[model samples]
Target: MTSAAIIPSTDLDRPELRRPMTDPFGRTIDYLRVSITDRCDFRCVYCMAEDMTFLPRADLLSLEELDRLCSAFIAKGVRKLRLTGGEPLVRRNMMSLVRSLSRHLKSGALDELTLTTNGSQLARFAAELADCGVRRINVSLDTLDPAEFRRITRWGELDRVLAGIDAALAAGLAIKINTVALKGTNEDEIPSLMRWAHGLGMGLTLIEVMPLGEIGEGRIDQYVPLSLIRARLAANYTLTDLPDSTGGPARYVRIEETGGRLGFITPLTHNFCESCNRVRITCTGTIHTCLGHEDASDLRRPLRASADDALLSAAIDRAIGTKPKGHDFIIDRRHNRPSVSRHMSVTGG
Candidate 1:
């Protein structure tokens, strides 16, 4: 497949627009994860460096541009739209984007409009998000301990985040807690965290530390395979594998003890690339076809070149055509570098 940047402006001008986006591997690309900003309030140790350099605000697409780009995707059969960020709520006027995108949900073009947030600003924005038609959201919370939370996030306030979660729950939003299982840090707290989330009627998902970016430390030390977590859980409770997918790379299981659902995202021990039906777009309007690959298509130029989406749509199509069947993610024991150099926050997750 060719790069969309090199494609002529006049290419793909056919009247038959809005084709269902399907990759060469026959996976229907229906989910789009868009990063509104690369700036976060707290610098998580596993996600980014403590003193990190972020993209300038000028490099990020404006709210209007994001709306148009997302609309183009919805026109092409993207049923789900998720807005993400280093911390999406930290962005000024971020709710404007959410409120605008809720139009798709109202029109029935989009099945769901949601967000993956760190829950720092959810206390202030939870009501607005629910008013804008966000029924469910994913909050990334690794540990429930306040001191450990401070150690992990570096700048996050545990009480503030908990208050935000309470506000979201009070707003009637279905919440899913995403925890990254760290070997020595939060591994011991996994069971307690799971029980806390399930006890509150929120689903908890444990994710393996992926080799994605240089977080100024060795991922080998932080990595904890979900297989091991499942094994440990089996010693005390029964875990029944369940066929459940939330349009992402997670396998679900029913814990008979808690009578609640649990999810595991094992990118290193087991990959879900074969069933990947989503792609991510950065704040700078670059479309990454796969999270593990460096190859990307520039949609900003086409998006800014013309108001019409003909060139932008063609670029998206070309990018999807190049989607690899699987990704190569390995955490090197000897190296501090990652297999994929880009940070997970850059790719919106």
Candidate 2:
């Protein structure tokens, strides 16, 4: 582990020399997704192989170091923060970090704070997290069938996950159910998942399976496009577009007379990279300019070595300066791309 250097406060005021880099899309990259830990109890097939390698404890960023990085990012125009991981709740004292971040937010440093979890542990942590100022949660649950859930996740915690979802709603956390639509696996469960989420008064998002890293080898053909998902839903349900919602990656629609809405993310067939406005910070403090691209800027070293805000700001500027215009996953071999990182668990989805 490397120790951070302390510097004088006078250096923080220097004007940043770097300029913000904009992609072809007009959206400014102000959102930061931080992966708190790579450790998770359940092994989902889409995110991990049956036999997967885990990062050593010494390799992950310390909580204090993570706080420093996050504080600096907030100062650099990052208003939205999403804490993610193999499952962020698996990190011990995660609520402590959430509390600290809430303080920063209360002080007007951050505008929004959210998290993405597998929901296996949400029942235990939902209330505590709600008290910590986490406003939203995105839970990954592909199937409503218990047998298929166990088969897909390789774990028998389906009941526990459902309980967690109920707890989150009770705790007043805005919930979004994220389901990855795979052809032979969980495609048949889309309507069921949507109906369940809607009945619970929660939003639902169906994501097209993308070819990510080593786990993506046999999963490419399983991607059931968003168009098909919508068409299937239209057969039995009346689909109405919510025009007030802004268009980005997901196509937002609502079922008539239903209180809940649905979202569709078709990255493979319909690229959303043009409207992408987010970057990610890996568990080890590497700044990823794009999710599809693995090349990243190292900010841990400079952040630890300098207390100067200007220097920190400059480092952020440099990271965003390298943000790519768009990814070429369609023409290029995304799974085989040398730049793609090995594990999504550590990278933060």
Q: How would you encode candidate 1's per-residue C-alpha lDDT over 143-247 as one tens digit per residue?
A: 999999999999999999999999999999999999999999999899999899999999999998988888999998898888898999999999999988755
Flag regions of model 1 displaced more than 4 Å.
1-15
Give residue 176's error in model 1 in angstroms. 0.3
Model 2 is weakest, by summed lDDT over 10 consecutive residues, at 1-10
Best by TM-score: 1
What RMSD does each model have against the real structure? 5.5, 4.3
lDDT of 1 at 77: 89
Pairs of colliding residues, candidate 2: 4-304, 5-304, 5-305
